[model samples]
Target: MVQQWDIVKIIGAIALPQMGGWVNGYLTRQEIKGWYQNLNFPSFRPPNWIFAPVWTSLYAGMGYASYLVWRDGGGFSGIAQGPLFLYGTQLALNWAWTPIFFKRHELKWSFVELAALTATVAATGFAFFNINKLAGYVFIPYFAWCSFATLLNYKIYKLNPESTATIEEVKEPKKKTN
Candidate 1:
């Protein structure tokens, strides 16, 4: 007998962060061609379209693993609290990266955020593994992806140091008083 805390809930937990991320990604995608996608990439860059499915699958894995922890690890009271907190922390960091990199066009700062997100995910994985080996192991792929992303983010930053958006420069000067 599956309870309320089943696959659907797990998927929902996983999807929540992704939902915010996708909105940011989609809203900024139209401007990406001249801004981000065409920037010089490392030789190891994967084709662009691959990111969608890869992220989708990874999100699913994240959801399932978190569910296992929530269900099997005593529902955030005893052993589950630590891992869940770490998971939520990393998830927020994960949610922030897209908007920073894509919408704000802050490559160097985005790399910084990616570095934090990668580290947070690693910490979450350790906490989760301590609670449930499967839960912790599930994050391994996400950690790996984030690790790769750190390098990719750095490469993009190096490749286009001049392309950062200048919000301050875009602001209009105050009009002279009458």
Candidate 2:
């Protein structure tokens, strides 16, 4: 039995991450383009087009998982606040990583943020299990993706130590065209 708030919970879950994705895209549009075109990415990198669909699906899963917990009356109303709070915290951390990495160009700190996010996700999943085991299961893929992303962030950081500089901070020597 889905309540009206259930839909809102689900939407909130997905929308929050979607908002993060939007901010990431909006703020990093040029950086993202230049990354693909210019950076020495790790060999295992996926096509840029792949990120949209993958994140969309993952966000859906996250939202559904959260909806299950929220609908079960496990959020602020029950003993589940700790877990949900962890969930919310991780989501915020997830949101901030983009700006840290792209806008501020803090690859090293971005990786640190990812590490915190990974820990938070795990705590949230474990907390979710206490309330709804199925909800805990839903986060498995999200957890996996974050783990993979941590490694990817590290690789990117290693590949482009110069990326620490914001676009304006680093000056490129101009090439003369014929």
Candidate 3:
């Protein structure tokens, strides 16, 4: 039997991760269509159309997993603190990846970030599992996807070495003071 507050928590939990992704997507939209389109992706890279649906599903799953962890581990109480912290950390890393990769075009740095994100995600999953088995289990697909994405990022970094070069900033002419 689910209570009213439970429903609210469930909705809130699920929406949180999705919201992070939305913000990142919104910020990186221009780069996705422009800079990202020019990248040399691996043969295994899926079509652009696949990313939205796949990521949406993955975010939803991760949200639900967090909800389970929250519910089963005793909300924000001491017991849930560690797992939730890991969740928040991974979520932040997840949000940071797109802008780093797409907008800034920092291929190598983005790959490094993604690798860290993957490890943090794996740790979070394990922590969630300790709280609730289902919560841990729900992270499987996310972990798998992250692993795949890490490989893809690595390949992109390798294939596009020129992308990693530091851009020389052209200084504006010194303004003449009145």
Using TM-score as the measure, what is the rank order of every candidate, best first?
Answer: 3, 1, 2
- Cα lDDT tens digits for candidate 3, 153-173: 999999999776543321234
TM value for model 2: 0.84
Candidate 3's displacement at residue 15, Å, is 0.6
Could you tell me which residue pairs clash in candidate 3? none
- Compared with the true structure, what per-residue lDDT tens digits does model 2 show for residues 4-48? 876776787777767777777777676777654676679998887
Candidate topping TM-score: 3
Task: Give candidate 2 misplaced runs (Cα > 4 Å).
Answer: 3-5, 166-178
For model 3, the local distance difference test gives: 0.89
- The residue pairs found clashing in candidate 2 are none
Clashing pairs in 1: none
Task: Name the weakest run of 10 consecutive residues (lDDT summed) in model 2.
Answer: 166-175
lDDT of 1 by residue, 1-178 (tens): 7776565787686777678667766866776676666678889989878887878887777877777788777987967888888888888888888878877778889999999999999998998888789888988999999999999989988988765655553365446798
Model 3: CA > 4 A from native: 166-178
Question: What TM-score number comes out for model 3?
Answer: 0.91
Q: What is the descending lDDT order?
A: 3, 1, 2
